[model samples]
Structure formats: C-alpha cells, structure tokens
Target: MISWQARALNLFLKQTVKRSIENTKDVNKLRFQMRALDKFVFGTSSNIERSQSMREGTLCDEIKLKFSNSKKKLLYVHGGAFVFKTPAIHNNFIARLAEPLDLHAIVPDYPLAPEYPFPAALDSCYVIYKSLLDAGTLPEDIIIAGDSAGGNIALSLLLRARRNGLPMPNCCVLISPVADMTQSGLSSVENRYSDALFSLDVMLYCRNLYLEGANHDLHNEEISPLFADFTGLPPFMFHAGSTELMRDDSTRLAEFMQAHGVETHLQVWREMPHVFPLFEQLPESKAALQQIVDFIKKQQN
Candidate 1:
C-alpha cells in the first residue's frame, strides 16, 4: 500500500510538475524552470561539503558528508533527462547515502544534451572513471550510481569501461533508469496514466533533444543500454515504481543482467512516482534509501 504522503505527493505532482513538463515546449526554459522548482522544493544539503575539480578537462563536483572518513567513493551521475545539471534533490539523496555509508561522492557536471549530445556525456563520464582509477582508488572501493538519464549513463559507462578492459566498480545502483531509449517497454504504455511525474510525450521530447546531433540511433547499446552486452558488469541494484512509465526499463534490464550471470536486485514499489526515492518526505523513500545503503555495504563484504 502506498503511504498517504506518497499519495498526496503524487496528486500534487500530477497537477503541477506533470502539467508543467507537458506545457513546456522549449528545452532551455524547461531546464531553468525545473532547476528552480527543485531548489524551492528540495533545498541543497547543508551537511555535505561540496568542492569542484576538473577531470580530463570536464568540470566535476564532489560532495562528502561532514566528517565521513571512509576511503570508499561513490560516482553519482545526476539525472535531468540528459539536459539539466545535478539538482538539489540528488544532492540531498547523495548526502543521505554518504552519511550512512561514509562515502566520498563524485558528481560529474557533464555536458548537457541538444548542445553536447551522444558521445559527449558518455565520454566525459568515462574519463572521470578512468581518472578515479588512475588516482589509486581501488575499483572495489567505488560504487557507481545514477537516477533516470544518469542511470542510463552509469550503465553505458560500465559497458564502455569493460570494452576498454577497465575493472568494474564494486556495484551499481539505478533509480528509475531510462534504460530503453526506443520506448519499447510495455509500462511506457500500460502505466501512461498511473505515473504522475512523466508522460510519454515528455519522454519523447527529451529523447529527441538528447539525440539531436548524435551519430548513433536510439537502439545503440551505448545510448539505450537495454541492447548492450552485460557479460562482465558488476552487481546491480535497481529501484523503480510499478506505476512508472519506464518501470520496465529497470525490470527488463535487471532480468537481462541476471540472465547474463550478473547479480541484480530489483525493487518495484507499488503506485509510487518515478524515482520516488528522490522525494525524501515519503516513508517509502526512507526504506528505499536504506536498501541502497545496505546493498552497497553487502558489496563491500
């Protein structure tokens, strides 16, 4: 059963967030509006110390929970439909994870879509990962995570790393990932009305913008990841709402990974919003966050 808080939030999102996304036709305007809204609703974390550095010429941000002393690192890729930067909600979420897990989190402010599409984002993330390894951070001490479009990048980064013979991270966590860019998932149609945060049209709009100057098609494994080779990737934990338009993106990818002999844990919350864990007010969000912490801990052991 969905909590009252989640139910209420869903209704609120449908009337405001969902409608706003549907009505916004200009990508730049939408990005600015969403960033402002996210800041207003979910303010940045005060408990995390933030700093910036350049990785392979691309600016990257780092966040660490105050007093965290662990050597482990979290390579978090923030999601904004491949357009926007790391919003406050993601910063708060990372703080929650970093506090309990004692992790040093690295967030890459990769180039956005419509301006720097396709290989740009993917290549930036790859260089960041390579930099981490070169700096003597053991792969086993690292955790790669992302939400929505960032999840897509996280998975694609691993595939690229594997092809280049880089060691896999300890594990990966994907929150409501957009795994299938082709929009072939059944939930994309089945849960069209159930999902309060996204509509099919909005997803297509983002995809078009993201692929505007891309050389590859939507089916390219690097872009969709649903069609990629997962032969030797690390363990994965996937979370998605059952009512999400792209719920099957997580489900199908988890199933595929399991078939490829990779360990995977998939959690589908009933009637929750897309990337529901980002809404920290929900009790369900607390539980999901705990599960992610536990998953990372288990990987370490």
Candidate 2:
C-alpha cells in the first residue's frame, strides 16, 4: 500500500510537474523547475558524502555515491532527456539505490541539448564510462541504471560499450525509461494524458533539440537497443508503472530480451506513476526498492 504521504506528494508532484510543463515556454524554464526541486523535492539525508569527478576537461556531476562501501560498483546515469535534471534535484531518488545496495554510484551531470546537442550527452556518458574503466573500475562489478531519460542513456551506453568491445556490466536497471527518444511508441501517445509529469509536446521538443541534425537512423540498434541484439549483455530488471505513460517501453523491452534468451525481470506496479521509488519512505516505494536490491544481489550470485 502507498503511504498517505506518498499519495499526497505524488499528487503534489503530478499537479506541479504538469503545470510546469504547460506554463514553461522553453528548455531553460524546464531547467528552472529541476533547480527549484533541488530545494523542494531533492532535499534528503545530507549526512551522505558527495564528491566531484571530471573528464576530458569538462566538469561532470560525479558523486562519491553513498550506495554502500561494499565494492566500487555501478556506473549510474541520471535521466533528464538530455535537457534537464541534476544530482541535487535527484538526490532524493539516488540515495535509495546508494544506501541499500552499498553501491558506489558515479553519476555524471552530462551536457544537455539546445546547448550541447546530439551525441554530446550520449558521448559524455561514454566518456565517463571509459574513464571509470580506465580508473580501475571493473566492468564485472559495474551495473548501470537510469530512470526516464536516464534509462535511455544507460541502455544506449551499454550498446555502445558492446559495440566497442568493452566488457559488459554485471546487470542494468531501468526505471520508467524513455528508451525510444523518437517517442514513436504507442504509449507515448496512448498515455500522453495518463502520466502527470510528462507531455507529448514537451517530449517532442526535447527530442528535436537533442537530435539536432544527427542521423535519424531509427533502425540503428544504438538508437533503440530494444530493437538491437541484447544477447550476452548483463542481466536486467526494469520497473515501470502500469499507469505510467511509458509503461509499454518496459513491457515490450522485457519481451524482446527474453525472446533473445536474455535474463530479464519486469515489474509493473498498478496505479504507480513514473519513478515512484524515489518516495521510498512510502510503503509501496520501499517494496520497489527491495525488488531492485534483490535483483542486484541476484546478479552478484
């Protein structure tokens, strides 16, 4: 059961995020909202330590990542559609993954579009992953995870790693990922009104800003790994809400992976919205977090 507090905050976020999308005129305004959440929604246990990591002379949002001191594990990518969101705004969400699994999450605040554009965000993630590997991070211990747009980035990074013959991660997690940036999936339109935070118009605008003259090769596996060969990669577990607009992304992706003989776990939380695990203090949210942690442990075995 979802706690009353979670329900209330979910309602509040639903209203505020939807209204923000409607009221905002451009991408910068969108960033303004994420920054505002830093003071509002992003505030969590500040007892955790945070640090920075830079690559190729560009400043990236690298956190000492308080998952667990277990072993340096997981190269996490934060989802923002290559447009908005930062570690501060997403602290409330990332802290859950950090504390439970004892993971060292290296979260990078990659450059966004309408400013950096196209391969910049994707390439930024690639550079961070490569830097981590070069810095002595074992590929076997690294599990990638992302939510919404971050999920897309994580999966794309995995595909890129495979293409470059980089060792595969132990596993990966996707929370309400936007795997297909084209937004051509049925859920993108079908649930346009079902999700509270995301809107079709704004998603399309972000896509245009990011794709900015890049190859529109929709069939490219890297563009949509759901369409690519996922064999011999890490095991994966995905959480997508039944009521969320991007539900079908996970549903279809799990099916494709299993058909290709990939081990995959897919959970559909009825009535839950996108990335509901951020509210881990809530009963249902805790359950989702437990599920994720269990999946990580299973990958270890």
Evaluated with TM-score, which candidate comes out highest?
A: 1
> Candidate 1 on 178-203: residue-level lDDT in tens?
88988899998999888897788888
- Evaluated at residue 267, the lDDT of candidate 2 is 93
> On residues 1-301, what C-alpha lDDT tens digit does candidate 2 reach at each position?
6467666766776788767876355888888876775565535455455666667554654443444355656677777767887566465566666666667767777887878886777788887788778778787778888888788888888889888988888899899887765566788877877776677777777777777756678656555667878887778899987767788889888998898788999998866777777655457777888899999888887
TM-score of each: 0.95, 0.89
Candidates in order have lDDT scores of: 0.88, 0.75
Model 1 lDDT-worst window of ten:
36-45
The predictions' CA RMSDs to the true structure, in order, are 1.6, 2.5
Off by over 4 Å in 1: 40-47, 213-215
Inter-residue clash pairs, candidate 2: 67-98, 67-102, 67-103, 68-102, 68-103, 79-150
Q: Model 1, residue 80: what's the lDDT?
A: 89
* RMSD from true fold, candidate 1: 1.6
Q: Tell me the lDDT of model 1 at 18.
A: 84
